[model samples]
Target chain A: MHTATHSGALMAETTSTKDAEFGAWMTARQPALLRTAYLLTGDHHSAEDLVQTTLAKVYLSWDKVQKREVIDGYARRVLVNENNSVWRRAWKRRELVSDQLPERTGRHDSYDEGGSADLWAHVATLPRKQRAVIVLRYYEELSEAETAEVLGISVGTVKSQASRALATLRATAHDRLGLGEEER
Target chain B: MNHDHDDLAAQLGRQMRHEVEGLDRAPLSLADVKGRATRIRRRRAALTGAGTAAVLAIVVPMAMLAGQFTNAGDDVGPATDPPSVSPGPTEPPDQGPVVGVGESLDTADLPIGDVPAVTWLENGSVLHTADGENIRLEGTYEDVVRYDDGWLGIGGGLAVLLDADGAETGESWVTARNLATGQGGDVVLFVADGELRLHDNVDGETTVLRDGMPDTAEMIGVDDEDTAAYNLVGPQGEPFAALNRDGEETIPDPGTDAYVLNDVTEAGWVSAITQLMDDGTCSRTVAPNGDVAGETCELMFDRFSPDQRHVIAGPAYADGYGAGQLAVLPVDFTDGDDPVLELLQSGARDATLMSWGWEDDDHILVVTATPVDGSTDMTWQLVRIGLDGTVENAATPVRGDEFAFPFALTS
Candidate 1:
C-alpha cells in the first residue's frame, strides 16, 4: 500500500513538471502562431480558433516532438492541414448574408492610407493553395523547399504558385494601386 | 530573380508583417489548450473501448454456437462406439412473420459482397475507381463528383475536368462558389461573379445561363434536361427555392409555406422539404411546371434511388447523431395505399446508420454502427437493404472508429 501511494505521487509530480514545460514553450510560441494563423485564415475569429485547435493537436503529440528546433515546423504543418480541412467543410455551414451581390472595385479605392490593405485584400482572393504558398514564402520567409514540405507538395508546385500569385499581385499593384512605376 | 521581382517580394513581406502587427497577444492560454487535449484523449479512449466491446459481443456468440454444435455430436456417442446420427429438424425454426413489407432476413446472417461504390482521400490526394480503373488525383481538390464519362474535381478556386481514366482533359474553370452538376454529369452549372453559367462538357462551350443573381444564390442541382434548381434568400431573409429552365427563372409556390429544394430528378421533378410542425418536416415532390405532384408528412427524403423509381428517406430528425430510422418510398404513390417501406435492417434500437448510398435500383447500401453494450464505442458494418425488405451485409463487420473505414461510403 505504501509503495503504491509513493508511485502515484511520483507519477503526478512527473506529469506536473512535463505540463509546466509545455506551458512555457506554448507561451513563447503563441504570438507567432497567432500571426501565422491570421494570415492563413484572413479573419481574427477564425485565426484564434485555428490556433486553439492546432495547439491542442500539438499538445496531444507533445511527446513525439522531441526536438525544440523542429517544433515550429511540426506546428505549421498541422496549422496548414487543419486550414485545408476547414475550407473543405466551409460550404456546409455557409450562410447567405446578403441578397445583392457586392460590386467589385479597384483595391485601392477604399484603402488610401497606403497600398498595404489593398495588397492584403488581393492576397485574400487568391486560391487557397496559392495563398498558402505566398504566406509561407513571402510572409513566413520560408524557402521554396520548406514551403513545399509544409504544404506536402512538390518544390516545383511551390515555385509555380508563388510565381502566379506574385504576377497577379504585381499587375494589381500597377493597375489599381498605381505603384511600381520603375519596374514598368 | 529580376530586381523588380525582388523588390515586390520584399514589399509583400513587409505588408504581411504590418497586417498582424496589432495582434500582440494570443487568444488562448496553455491551460485552455491542455483542457481541450484532455477531452480529445478521453473521447478517443472511449471509442477504442467501445470497439473492443463490440468485437467481443460478436465473437462470444459465435463461439458459443460452435461449442453447442460440437457438444451435440459428442453427446450422441462415445469416441470408440459407432456414432448414430440424429435426424435434423424437418423444418427451419419459424422466425416470426417478417416485419414491414416484402421479405426479411436475420441481421446476423447477412451475405457479404463487393462494395458498389468507393472514394477516399489519402495523403493530400483523392483516389477513386472509374469503370474498374484506378484513378488518382494529386491536385488539391476538396471534393470530386463522378460526371458523365469523367469526374469534376473542385477545389483551390478551380474546377478540373478529368477523363474516365483520371487524365485531365485540358478543360477547367475558375469557380467562386455554388457549383452543381447534372444527373448525367454532362453539364456543370456554377455561379461566378454574380452570373449563373452552364458549361456543356460535350461541346466544351460555356454560356451564361442567368445574370444579376444574388451572391447568396446557391446552385443545388441541375437536371439532364438543362433545368437547374437553386436556393436563395428572399427579401425578408427567408430561404426559398427557385428553378431556372433555359434562360428564365421561376420561384415555384407549392403553397403559402416556403419549401427548401432538396434534389432535382433528371426529368426535372424536384424533391423539396418544408417545416410542417415543431416536431418534424414534410417532403413533397413538385413538377417542373410548379405543380404539387405528391407529398408525404413526417418524413424528409434525401436522394432518389438509382432508377429514380424510389427514394430513401428518414424521420425529420434523428434521435442521436447518425442514429435514425430509414425507409424507402415509391416516387409515385396513390392516396389510398401505404407509401413507407420501412427497412427492417435499420430497425435496430441502438444502432447508428452512419452513412448510406444507393447500391442499385433495388438495394440501398448503409454503413451502420451499433453501440457496444450501451457505451460510446460502436461496431461498424456495411449493410445493404433491398426495396423488397431483404437485408444483407455488404462487408465484414469492422471494430474501430470512423478512421478505420477509408472509403467515402456516404454519397
Candidate 2:
C-alpha cells in the first residue's frame, strides 16, 4: 500500500493503489518465499500457511517497506519469526515428539530416493535454529550476516550453528548414503 | 569451502527446488491474502488509534499538571472515612472518579475518592484508595490482586503482601509465577516455576500442595476449595492432556479428545472440541463428569462471568467469520443451538473493542477505542457496561508520559 507521510507529520496518508503494486510483487516473489518456507518447515501445508501469514504481515506494514530492497528482508524476518514462535508453542505443547509417529507418511515419501532427498532428510533432522541457519545461508543464499539478522542472532552464533549443522549432515550422509568418511 | 560440503550444499538446494516443485503453486490467492491483510490492518489501525488517543488524553495533561504542581509543596491529603454501602443486593454506587491524570484529577480533592479500590499510575506506582483517601505504594509490580486485608503484588519473581496502608508487610522469594485467589478463604494458589505453593494468610502459613509438576504445566485458576485447574501438556508437550483439577501427582487423563480447554467453572469445564466440519472449532460447556451441559458452534469460549451464570463469548460471526464482538451467553442455554447473544460492545468504523474484564457481578469493564469525530485517530477509554447495556466511563482519561492499562480492579 502507498502510504506517504509528510515530514514531521503524525499520520501517514494511505492509498489503496499501493496494494496493486504489493499484490504484483507478492505474486512474483511467492514461489521463492514458498521454497524457503517449505525448507524451513518440512510440510507443504505448513509452508503455505507460513507464506500466507508472512505475506499478510508484509502487506500490513507495506508502507514502511516501500523502498523495494527492504520488502523481501522484512517478509523473510516475519516468516522466520512466525516459524520460531510456532516452534516455541509446539515445544511448549510438546508436539515435537519424534516417537509418536505421524499418521500419514505419504507427504514425506516423495523425497526419499535420491542423494538430494538424503541430504534434505538429514537437514530436517537438525534442530530448528540450525536448520534455519543452514537453509538461509546455503539455500536462500543469504550472507552469514544476513542470516544472523534474519534469525536475530549474532554472526558468530550463526557461524557455529551452521558449522555444527553441516558437520551433522555430513556424518548422517556417510551413515545413510554409504559415502566415504572425510577427514574433519 | 570443502568439496564435500560444497557438493552437499548443491544437493540440498536441488532437493529444496524439488520439494517446492512438488507443492501446489497457489494454496490461497493474492486476493484472499489481501482480504486477510485488510482485516489485520483494521485491527492494527484500531490499536494505533487507541494508543495515540491514550497519549493525548493522559500524557499531555499529566505533564502540564506536574509542571503546575512543581512550585507548590508535595503534600498528600489526609485520609477520609471509607464510603459506606449498606449490605444489600444492589450494584455499588458509581465510585466518583476512580483514577485520572492531569486536569481530570483535581489534585485539591486528591485522595477523596471511593475506598477499597486499587489503581496504578503509568510508572507502576499503585494507589490504594479507600475511605475516600489514597495511599501511594511506590514500586513496579508485574501483577497485583486484592486480598482480604490488602493487595498482593507479584513481580521480579517474588510475591509481596501490602497492608491496607500500601505498606509492605511480608515478602517472599517463592518464584511466584501465577496467583489465583478463590471466593472466600484466605487461601491463595501460587504456581511457582514448577511447583504448586498454597499460601494461607489466616494461619500465616504456606505449604506445597504438589511439587515436581511438569515444567510445561500451566496453572489456570484455583477454586474456593484450593482445587486448582491446570492446562496440562502431554509427555511430548502436546496440548492433549485433560482439564482436570487434580493433586500434583495425579495424572491428567489423556482420553479426552478436546484440542483446547477454555474456562473452568464449579459446574464443569468448557472446551474447544475439534470438529470435522467447515470451521473446525466447536465449543462445548461440559460438566465435571464429562457430560455435555451445552454445546455451541462458537470458535472460542473465553471467560465465565463472576456469577458463572453467563459466559463472555465472542465477535458475532456466522460460522466462525468476522472481526467479532464480545457477547455474553447465558450459562444454561438448551432452548436452541443459536440463542440470543447479549453483545457487550461492537466495533465501530474507527474504533474496536480491544479487551474486557468483569468489574463486578453486573458490570463488564471494557477497554476500547473512544471514537473521535471525523478523525481516524481514536483514544482508548475504560468503559463499564452494565448487564442492561448501560455504558459509563469508569476511569478518567489520564494524560501521562506513557499509556498504562488499568490491569486489574481490586474492590
Candidate 3:
C-alpha cells in the first residue's frame, strides 16, 4: 500500500512538472504566434482565434513533439494548415459583394489611405495558395523548403505559386506603381 | 527579371509595415489565451474519442475472425515472422543557405503617378510628391514624420504639416521633440518645455489636447483612441504612471525602484520595464489594476515590433561603440537564463544602425551608417533582414538622385 501511495505521489509530481513546462512555453511563445497569425489573417480577432486553436492542438500532441528545437517549426506547420482549412471553408461560403473592387481595378483617385493600401489590396486579391506563398516567403522570410513543410506542399509548388503571384501583381500594378517597362 | 520582383517585394514590404504600425488591438493575457485553448482542446478530444470508438468497433470483430484462421496456419510460417528489422536513422533534408543574388537596382520606368514618399534633399529642403508632382519646402528640417494623409516636420522656426501634394495644411506650432499621433486623425503629441503636450490640427483648428503636467512626466505614446501613456515620478520619488484616454484617473505607484513603465500596449495594459542598473533587462506586461500578466528578459530592447511581440536588440553597446552584434528576439524569451536571439548580419566595425522598421511580421528593414574612410561624412545603406537570418541589400524606395534620404514610403 505504501509503495502504491509513493508511486501515485510521483505520478502527480511528474504531471505537475509537465504542465508547468508547457505553461511556461506557451506564455513565452504565444505573442509571436499571434503576431504571425495576425499577418496571415489580416485581422486581430481571427488571428487570436487561430492561434488559440493551434495551441490547443500543439498541447494535445505535446508528447509527440519530442524535439524541443522544432517546437516553433511544429507550431508554424499547424498554423499554416489551420489557416489553409479556414480559407477553404471561407471561400466556399464567399458571396459576391457588388461594391467590392475587381482584381484589375486600380485605386480610386481620392483613395490615399497610404501606399500600403494598394499593395495590400493587390495581395488581398491573390488566391489563398498564392497569398500563403508570398506571406511565408517574403513576410515570414521562410525558405521554399520551410514554407513547403509548413503548408504540406512540394518545394516545386511553392516556387511555382510564388512565381505566378508575382507575375499577377506586376501585370496588375505595373502601371499603378509607375515602373519602367525594361526587363531586368 | 528578378530585380523587378525584388522592387515589387520591397514595395509590398513597405505597405505591410505601414499597416502594422498603427495596429491597436488589445493583447491577449496568459490566462485568457489558456482558457480559450483549453476549451478548444476539450471539444477536439471529444470528437476524436467518438471517431476512435467507431473505428475500433468495426476493426475488432474483423480482426478476431482473421486471427483464428491465421492461427490454424501459424505452424506453416516462420515461428515469429522474424521480428521486423528497423531501418537506421537518416539525416533530415536541408534547403541550405538563403539566396542573396537579387540586390541590383531596378531602373524600370514606372508610370508617372502619385508616388507617395517623403524625401530630404542635399540642399536642406524637403520635397513632397503626390501623383508625380513635386513641391519643395524650403528650410533645414532634421527629420520628418509621416501620417496617412500628410507629414509633420519642423522648419522655418515652426512645426509644419504638409499634405500629400506638398501644400501646407495651415497648421503650425512651436517645435517639439518626441512626436506621436493617436486616433485623433490629425492630432499630434510632442514634448514642450518640460511637459508633454498634444496639438490637434484636425478640421483646420489647432487645439492643445493636454498640458500642465509635471516636468518628470515623459509621454511614452498614444493608443488608437487618442489615449496617452506617461511615465512619471511619484510624490515619494518612485515610478508612478497611468495610461488613460484622458489623464483624469489616479496614477498607480508600484513603489518599486527597479522598474518603470516603458510602453502601453493596444489593450491598455501597462508594461513595467527594468532600469539599466537592474540585474537583467526585462519587461513585464501588467494589468491596469497592477497585476503582472507576463514577463520577458533579454539583453536589450533597441526597439519593439509594431505588434509589440518581438524586439530588435544588439550587444554593440557592450563593446562600447563599434558595431558588435544585432539580433531579433521574441519579447518573452524563455530558453534558460540566456536570451535566445536570431543573429542578423554582424561584424562590421564603426557601423551604427540609425533606424529600423518592420517590413512584415517576420522581416525587418534596417538602415545603417558608417563613416567614410577619409571624410567625416557617413555612407548609408538599407538592408532587409529576415528572422531566418536572410540578409539582402534593398533598393531605396525613392527614385531619382534629387532627394537622397528616404523619410517615409507611403501608399
| Ten-residue stretch with the least lDDT total in model 1 chain B | B79-88
Could you tell which candidate, 2 or 3, scores higher by DockQ? 2
DockQ of each: 0.19, 0.15, 0.07
Rank the models by TM-score, top first. Answer: 2, 1, 3
After aligning candidate 1 to the native by TM-score, how far in Å is the CA of A65 from where it should be? 52
Displacement of residue A98 (Cα, Å) in model 2 is 31
Indicate the residue-level lDDT of B58 in model 3: 25
Q: What is candidate 1's lDDT per residue for B1-411, written digit by digit as tens?
A: 555557667877888999999888866887789887786665455333432342233232222222221232333222213212222123433442222542232345456766455453322244544244456774645456665567767554566777776677887766544466675666777765557777787887767878887765656777655777787776533567777767787666534556566667555555666432222345565443333444555456666765566666655533223435566666643223354455433443345565566777667777666645544345667777655555566666766542233233412
lDDT of every predicted structure (CA atoms)? 0.60, 0.51, 0.49
Candidate 3 lDDT, tens digit per residue, B1-411? 365566666666666655566454436554564576676554444333432342233232222222222232333222112212211113322532232322211112212222222233222345543233444654444444454466666433345666665567877655442355543235555544433555455654333445555543444556444566655554433444554455343344333323344554333334444332211234444332233333444334444455545555543122211233455555544223232234433333344444455555556665445544444344555556555544454534332211123443211
Which residue pairs show backbone clashes in model 1? Answer: none
Of 1 and 2, the candidate ahead on TM-score is 2
Q: Can you tell me the CAPRI class of model 1? A: incorrect
| Worst lDDT 10-window in candidate 1 chain A | A93-102
